[model samples]
Target: MDELVERVDAEDRVLGVVSRRDAVREGWLHRIGVVVCRDGQGRYLVHRRAEHLSRFPGHHELAVGGAVGVGESYEGAAARELSEEMGVRATVCLRFTFLNRSGLSPHWLAVCDALLPEAVAPDPREVAWHGWLTEPELRQALGQKTFTPDSREVFDRYLASRAAPATVRNRCP
Candidate 1:
């Protein structure tokens, strides 16, 4: 079954609704919500994409998520994805960090952050392997060609935010 997703513009204004396949094949700008999961120790939950995925198969992703459905808020999508892909509920608010664009994918990505207090149970269909990594470790891993393009962009932006000063980071919405 084709998943229904909201098509949007470069600025993320909704243009219409379309099938996920059409959104990709026709290069329609669509929204996807990503949740950056962190453990109590501040290690990030990184996972390898399932090999059977249609795009970026066997690549690493900094978060678990998917396209936002029609009439769904980014936060809602992020929460849903966190549950569906990782089987973990975020006890705190998933802060909307930033928007990332790869120019390689039609997805207008909304990145969020959540500190999960529960254990993760990655779904086999979306994640093949999972692990926790520190900032330096994630950056080093990103140097290799293992991460998906979109994921790389998202993680890079996230690391940049963390490195910025308190005031500077606060300026980001």
Candidate 2:
């Protein structure tokens, strides 16, 4: 809660840096960078957040991420999160960026995807449990409230991005 995070407006421009606690308490939009790791087999890494986490504890997440630092880029944040959580360094591409208003906290979530290397060791403190899940399995897991709402929103957007024609995808609003 005391972590310093970048604060942004509804339009996703960085306003300044604020404590994570203040941002959530005041409903200020902040930046969160998420990394969705996919193995060579195309299964995504899904994890249960540690119960001790202040936000979205014990919830299923399609990505591993956290608030972006004051001076960090979205892509950098995503890569850092992947390294921290999975103990593997990998390049992550920014797939999309959108304002997430799900649940109580609103944030400008930048979703990134990474191809997992051969090594992966989930951090026990951050990830209580984790496994590779197919897209269908991921969809099925999202039915419960135990899944993070913003992540569900991300999944929806991900699906939309895949199904939408390239002509339409360029005009995301």
Per TM-score, the best of the predicted structures is 2
RMSD of each: 2.7, 3.0
lDDT of 2 at 25: 95
Q: State each model's CA lDDT, in order.
A: 0.79, 0.83
Model 1: lDDT to the true structure: 0.79
List ranges where model 1 is wrong by over 4 Å.
Answer: 91-104, 163-173
For all predicted structures, in order, the TM-scores are 0.87, 0.89
TM-score, model 1 to reference: 0.87
Judging by lDDT against the true structure, name the best candidate.
2
lDDT of 1 by residue, 51-153 (tens): 9988789999887788899999887888999998898887424444444556345677777778876478988998899999887888888887488777777
